[model samples]
Target: MPITLADKLVVAISSRALFDFEEENRLFERSDAATYLQLQRERLEVPAQRGIAFSLVQKLLAFNTPQMQRVEVVILSRNDPVSGLRVFHSAEAAGIALQRGVFTQGRPPFGYLRPLGAHLFLSANADDVTEALGLGYPAAHVYTDSVQASLAHPNELRIAFDGDAVLFSDEAERIYQAEGLEAFQRHETDRHGQPLPDGPFKPLLAALHRLQQIADAVPGMRIRTALVTARSAPAHKRAIQTLMSWDIAVDEAMFLGGLSKGPFLKEFEPDFFFDDQTGHVHNAAQHVPAGHVRSGFASAMVETTATIRKHQDQG
Candidate 1:
């Protein structure tokens, strides 16, 4: 018989996303690889600080018990093998049970997602994030410098997401981009009863919901989700309706009406937050462990065009 990942909720994350390496990353960026490798070797014994998705990885792994292996998290990193040594050491110091890893040594690691049966991939590299999304995998570019979530919610995993383009399709965003805000509002107001289409991170949300249900039965852990979007008033209705259509429920919903999401997110203190737009992602990153979902009408529409052209040529 052979071992298989068929039944696990697997997550593939990068060293940068899992542990703080911003200072080291800057060295890699400014100087050469040799210098970075030497530095990593020198400080191999020093465990790195917990990164953006640390709490997330920690909570999800808690679902695994001796009798039931409910989750699997693998280190899929672009860091060289030497730096990877520190990543493992840091995880061990943090008391996380990480058993597998792939050190790409500066190459893109997205290609391994399929082989790993990864339900989600989190990295700090935008290019890797984009590539993963194009392949239709759920991935996010973690904001490694973001403020970590509060210690208050120790037994609970708090996640927040943007509405359109992250959880729901970017249909309304496309409209807003083409027309003005008024037209976008009017459009949603008219069709508030209609559910928005599915977006990239919806499946992840559903998975978390299911995990919450399982945890609910056990009583020791919980998963809390929130919809923190720029849409407000009438436009907010469609986002809510979409979740209803999908039979999804979020613990909190904030329709900020084009305001800065940073302050609100600081108050919410999610373990992790996902948004599509760069501005929103960076803003919330300052206040919470945030990741850019990198999917929407613009990116997805181009992907659709390429697919359509290929199909036509094949036909």
Candidate 2:
């Protein structure tokens, strides 16, 4: 496909759209965590925000200007009427497209209802991004609970992501998280070199694969993706297997076992880097446009409505 503004897109979103995690059992009435998570799985809605992720995206938007030119944003939710409206209006104010619609939870996104062009598309709704990626559109997922940071202008818009959690399966990671790493490792090791079980990010990976094919056809144009994760050695075995099984191609792979990602990404010079962890995002943003992927099963750090009210009051 032609590298349109739609293709060269950069999105920054709030965490709720990216991941589904419970806010603390605080001001609100509490419910069973498992039941709550189960209910969340069935519904396609934005969860609460992670402060760190939100703050980072806001900082990114601050850097958006005429010099940057073509960039668009979609609030991605009907919830949070006020903030959503603010974001929608801001995009209009800046002459960028702001699409508002109900989207799937975690499937890869396809084309959207907008005129074709080169632009950055961002949203707070994590799940909606899967829709964008399914449609072969590039997007960013963010959270509400995030820290402030600079959104650098990219001369070369390189983007990176983790394969399994960020791109492929939640099954293995979920197993690791609940069942213990050893069990997860053993399960994966037994199934090592086996095909992936069609994780949520699969469609997105296919979309990226399509982009790569297009780039290949046209010279002087490039869209590259890197898989960077903590999975190494025996664990890394599964990731490679999954990629091969899916017939997807990743330009780079760095299996850093519990190491900081910032330094290496600094050298690679990606336009954006996305991961499921706050640590990687925290470090990556210092060097490039950074976003956090919101998974459907993560817990959310809920802030009181009063706190949000206070910020609105200040604003």
Q: Which one is best on TM-score?
A: 1
| Candidate 1 worst ten-residue window by lDDT | 297-306
> Best by lDDT, which number?
1
Query: lDDT of all the models against the reference?
Result: 0.88, 0.52
Query: TM-scores of all models?
Result: 0.90, 0.53
**RMSD in angstroms between candidate 2 and the native structure over all alpha carbons:** 12.3
- Rate residue 87 of model 2 by lDDT: 38
Which ranges of candidate 2 are over 4 A from the true structure? 1-121, 125-140, 143-156, 216-219, 296-315
User: Per-residue CA lDDT of candidate 2, range 1-315, in tens?
Assistant: 654455333443332433223252221136554544454444333324323333323323333444542233333342334334433444444433445433333333334424543133455555565455444444556533433332343222355786555676566777776788788778778888776565445554565566556443443445567888877677888888888877787889998876888887876666556675556776876765576654423312222444688899999
lDDT of 1 by residue, 134-204 (tens): 88788998877788878888888898988888888889999988898999999999999998878888778
- Which residue segments of model 1 deviate by more than 4 Å? 297-315
